[model samples]
Target: MDFLPPLPLLIAFCGASVLLAVTPGPAVFYIITRSLAQGRRAGLASVAGVALGNLGNALGAALGLAALFAISSIAFTVVKYAGAAYLIYLGIKALRRPAEVRDAALGTADTRRIFRDGFLVALLNPKTAIFFAAFLPQFMSAHGSVVGQSLLLGATFVAIAALTDTIYATAAGTIAPRLRGNKRAGAAGRYVTASAFIGLGLFTALSGSSRAK
Candidate 1:
């Protein structure tokens, strides 16, 4: 209980999680594409798979993160700034590049296979762990157990992502009829996500600076 983030920080984490979930990313595209191509069932399966994979990433990061922090304040500071830099870099890349969708043809009507693919896609991506390692700590209280906070917060993020991903999968047809081809919409989303990533990175960096001072 002491490890749990305060109510306001929890709310902020939830809001940030939602924004990241809604953004058109590999997992989002995977679920939506599955839904659009196969059906709602496949989409849902994919969501489940991806959720598990993301949770895996979260758990892995959380496990190592606390150990590193305990070992050295210098290591903690290094990771914090490094993560901020990575986020800023991602945002800039998203802005400069057009949004790309995962290949729809890669899946099939077999929900099991689709699920496996989804899980692998998420699990194989190293960036997911890095993002969690970077993003979750921004909201953590310095006074409590870092491991407990990381686990709780990481699970919360995965849950939020699963919910939003399910929405995307269920509404893929209606919301994104031409998601792959719609450069205009992609451009708009790009700008929004870019702004978010940049702002978050800046906030993290600035907050760390303030804490140091």
Candidate 2:
């Protein structure tokens, strides 16, 4: 299969994906919390989860489910609310947990668990599916096999996402110690994680539905 995306489109996709990856979202917040409370390894694992989840989103877009979600208000609402609820739940859980707890109760999180968390977080967001569905096709060539083009674009997206998220994890891990040593800083980190979750949930709930297909 001729899998190459058009050069310009590829560049655009890479740029957009990088921007999205770098932006602090629920995934970033979770990774930061894990890193601060546990260690670098946990944070890296969460990053892996996010990468896999993003891949799933790309797959959904390639397979046309994202388009269906975009068109169906009911389906979109269900997904949006579900995602929002999950975020809120995570936030409340984080807030209620004692500071002395280590590893974020993730049970000796390895690379697999970290990646799983990231994957589930990204995969659960219908907006990500819609994003891939709308964004990837813009760069896709009409002449090539659609599936091939999509896979290439999706892979590129995943690679960028992984790189960016890894950076976030590393940074969080590095900063975590300094923050942990200071009681006020540690408290702030916990509060920020909780706020991020609730804020993201509220944002998702209030956002107008997109009809993009």
Candidate 1 collision pairs: none
RMSD in order of candidates: 9.4, 3.4
Lowest lDDT block of 10, candidate 1:
98-107
Best prediction by TM-score? 2
Cα TM-score of candidate 1: 0.61
Each model's TM-score?
0.61, 0.83
Against the reference, the lDDT scores of all candidates come to 0.67, 0.72
lDDT of 2 by residue, 1-213 (tens): 467877887888888877877777656776776676556787888777777777877888888878888789888788878878777876787688776653233334456655665566677778878877777888888988888888789878778877877787788778665654566766777778778777867777777654211
lDDT of 1 by residue, 149-209 (tens): 9889989988988998888888864544454455565556556656765665665556532
Q: Which residue pairs in candidate 2 have backbone atoms (N, alpha carbon, C) closer than 3 angstroms, thus clashing? A: 45-114, 46-114, 48-115, 49-115, 49-118, 49-119, 50-118, 50-119, 53-119
